[model samples]
Target: MGNLSRKKKKNKKEKQKEKTKNNLIDLQMDQENEKIQKTIKIITLGTGESGKSTFLKQLSILYSTGFEESSRELYASTIQKNLIHYIKILLRAAHSLGIKMQEENIRLSRSFFAFDDLTTQSLQAIIQLWSDPGLKEAYERRSEFQLPDMSKYFLDDAERIGKSDYLPTDQDILNCRIPTTGVNELNIVVDDLPWVVVDVGGQRSERRKWIHHFDGVTLVVYVVALSEYDQRLFEDQTVNRMLESLDLFAKTINNECFENKNCVVLFNKDDIFRKKIKEIPLKTCFPNFTGENDYQSTCKFIQEKFDKIGRNKKRVIFYHFTCATDTESMRAVFDVVSSTILQNQLNVGGYL
Candidate 1:
């Protein structure tokens, strides 16, 4: 009787929590539909490495539900890998600081950047570009950095003071807008609020473009990786750079016009943080950590951040998802977006 009662109580509490969550969703939906047939556009604004691509991929799959696993696998193995490699080398060059690629390290290092997704890149944002495979980093193309003992030194560690393939130190800071489609799953009614997904590239110059594509973005999904926190300890400026970029993007928009724009700051992976549950709520582990449970935590944190900044945080909502394209992750990308659309009713009117 005691065990049954405790289980029943726990379940009862959980049910109550769920009821509250449903109420919030219904409220948001009602407000969203105040102006009937509102055409909500979902612009997926995010940076190159922020998992916007992955989210879109998931969304695509969800909308195209019932696709054969083989077809999805083929897609992931081909176009996805190509696109990923293209992005990785660009960074390896910058951070390697002109290190010559050791034949051995070249293959291994290349593998790390190969998978190329938000979670992977967030943990180690590809910082440098790789050199030609056969040639050593000390191999000359205008030849300034030459280490004497090739065996003693790691080829990648050599100085890149005068490398020819420099992307230049004077690149402009403009966020790149990656326009994507394949959102066949959700209804037009669900996506009523116009969405402009801004993909803020990590490099400073790349963030400038994020503002150009916000035609009618109603929500912002902040994809923070648990792995990134472990790697950077929030000490690295990578997270701040991302946040600052968002802040700047916000500044570009006319506050009066986009005032109702909702922000859903999603904490992407709880599966990665099983060990740190006691330290603090996964959402609040950093400076402005929020509470637990993906949806409520996200909404609370968004609300709190906006309140702190004197903006209408009430309009913002949040959620966490442990989504991956693989089979075992047991979660789908489109499902997250679908739930988000349902709960936030992002297309709802300017004001309830």
Candidate 2:
């Protein structure tokens, strides 16, 4: 009888161990399932230089540990590339406006076209062109042409960027403009929920690829440069940039695939707009706008222009005036956006 009792005790202990092991497995599986369920997919849409990439960079900076050392190094090369790009833009603008370049400046422009890649020496040559009185005059008339807002930024930093050991600071990298050629994605956990933020090229050529990403998106963050109200597209000078953005926003919201998705319309570049609003009338592009020259009234009028696009749509549209480079401001806006998304999701699930 003693031996039988001892055997029973051993079996009971083994059974308890197996039960705990199974429970742990079940717990881990539940955790994995929860992660998958909580994953939110967000896609950013806008015209080129509309702050889509900037917004993603802001997210990575605020939420993640910030960019890695290697990524910062990459921007050094990007900054150089941006200088070359800016020069090309200036050359094109000069050619279009029939502005004559000095012989030296002409030679410098030809040298850039000569090399497929930019060497340090070649970049220095470009920087020299910036000091040319003729080139400076042409750049002054850049507004007549469709140059990017960051043209001055790149031109101003040319000499530093031409150095062999120059490194881009966080702010430099943020302000540096690079046209996205394809879809770029960042996976970040914001407010404890996993998020996959997608940024695509915002140029007209890039718009065709956007439809491919529309299916699984949880939210669409549409960025429009508020300052672009006075600008024209680089690709097509005839079409106003702000009008193009308005049309794109309308098409995105009206799409059946994203009819249920939420949208956040960011009228970015509030800082630039604040500086130019008084000088450049809102009615310049939007003739129907009758608002005052103040920032509040101007932004309200701009918001209404965008709002009118989605008036018939069922999807909720939220508008914000944002300066994408401002981390503190963006952080606050992102918090509100995330909260709205969460609440809306819960309401959809009958949890609110």
Candidate 3:
């Protein structure tokens, strides 16, 4: 009986030691997890020029100090270069389409390629060409070719931007066109949580790099150019831009890596979409789209399309109609987004 009692006591002591070891291991794991969660990883995905970069810039303007004077000047130079390129694209498209430019405007178009800088003469010429009916027609057919959504915005401000002492405004910086080549990241602290926002190139060729950034991604901000409903992809003109974005969103959410991760879809460029629906019907891309050619109806229709893609997913998806260039609007929108992210993180961490 004494020997049996000793054996039982030894077993109980060993079990207690084992239990203490497990508790320490779990405590260490929780600490490591807390450290990992300290920095929230956010990934932005969408088709090229869907305002992904613009959204990042907005976050900087809202959360951090905005662009410095030197940065604004750099963007001014880029804007000038982009303006020249914009007109050149229009001119090329008009020529290819056999759209007749006025004889004087034709001369102006040819001269555009030679002058890299936007001078007073060039700015005047740009204004003159913008008035040309042929270029205007090319602008209308912009979807068939590659054109930045901000082409008109920059073109309209050509004279102001060409001034000798001109500096790019916040809006100009927001609307500037610079293709994200690889992965671009923004580190900012929102509501005391460190956030690392990863923006990858949304072009077909650049999408392959996205998977490398998928690890530890807490949230996905999938931007979609709402105005692109009638547009075609830059890489392949046969593919509708909106459809490409939809296909990408489908794959992104269904990817095993992104399973159960919350996603926020920003139906970006609402300003353009609201105006575009009046001119181009959404049915041009989605033929089965029976919704009226109105802003609310079309937006709902597009949201539903994305919603249908994510309906079966266990994760929550939120949608917002965003005009990325509008600072105040985006700030308000991101406020809600950041709060949702915080709550979702807390719930997932079992802190709720």
Candidate 4:
């Protein structure tokens, strides 16, 4: 009887030990799952010149180290080239508009375009040509033709940019226009959460590559340029830019692959939009819109168009007005973005 009693106690103890071992294994797995949940994967999507790359640059400035010296040199070179290209566009537009330049200025423009490289003499000519009433007149009608929205900002700083030792400032870097080609990935840790951000080219030709990145996307950040309402597509001038953006957004937001993903629609270029709205009516692009042309009403009108498209989707969405070149504004905007993402995780885990 004693032997039997001892065996029973031993078996009970062994069973308890086995249960504890199982519990530890379960706990470890739970911890690991929690860690995995903390990582956020984001993909930025938009039409060409819609401020996608600028948003990525802001992320780097905010979360990671800023650009290195060599990178700045490259941007500086691009900026110089951009300056020359912008002026040439203005000159051509001026000619088309029947705005005459002085004989000397015309000669300067012709010679300036022929130079294979940017030089001090060319910079002086640019400064002189920019002051011409005819060029300024053509610039006012820029909506009739394609030009980067940052043209005036950079042009106004012509003297500073023309210096031989000019280095692009952080603001300059943010405003610079560089088309993203294939795919660029940035890994940043924000608020103790690992973040993987992927930026793809927004051009129509580069959109085919976007499908591969869609598989594991945790969030889709659809950016739109509010100022594009008065512009046309560079690829196909016959099509209005804002209309193109809306069509693209509708397809992207309602995509079957993203039915379960969260999305954020950023009506970007608010600075330019605010100014343009006063001059051009919102109805130009959205003819169906009946709201007031003021900033608040116009912005809401545009947002509703996007909201209507995603109303039936199974995922949550957030919207914000953003000026990607403004770091302070972006800081506040992204804070909300991060909170929304975290809250979503809580809801998924039934912790809310």
Which window of ten consecutive residues has the lowest lDDT sum in model 4? 343-352
- lDDT of the structure predicted as candidate 3: 0.87
Q: For model 2, where is the 10-residue window of minimal lDDT?
A: 343-352
What are the Cα lDDT values of the candidates? 0.41, 0.82, 0.87, 0.88
Per-residue lDDT over 3-61 for candidate 3, one digit per residue giving the tens place of the 0 to 100 score: 99999999999999999999999999999888676778889999999999999999889
Tens digits of lDDT, candidate 2, 1-352:
9999999999999999999999999999998876666678889999998999999899989888677889878988877777777777777777777878788788778767665446877777777877767667777666577666776777887777777887887778778777899899999887667888999999989999999988767788999999888877888889888999999888877788777777888989889889888788888788987768789998888898888877554678888898998888898889889888656965775533
Q: In model 1, where do residues sit more than 4 Å from their true spots? A: 1-37, 65-203, 230-257, 275-314, 324-347, 350-352
- The model with the greatest TM-score is 4
What C-alpha lDDT, on a 0 to 100 scale, does residue 333 get in candidate 4?
A: 84
Worst 10 residues of 3 by lDDT: 343-352
Count of clashes, each model: 50, 0, 0, 0
Candidate 3 is scored at a TM of 0.87
- Per-residue accuracy of model 1 over 206-314 as CA lDDT, tens digit each: 5465555455555555454332232221223334333543453355322454556665444443443333344434443255563564544544554454345424644
Model 1, C-alpha of 260: deviation from truth (Å): 1.2
TM-score comparison, 1 vs 2, better candidate: 2
Ranking by lDDT: 4, 3, 2, 1
Which is superior by lDDT, 2 or 4?
4
Candidate ordering by TM-score (highest first): 4, 3, 2, 1
lDDT of 4 by residue, 76-160 (tens): 9999878888899999999888998888888888877785556887788788999888888888888888878898888889989
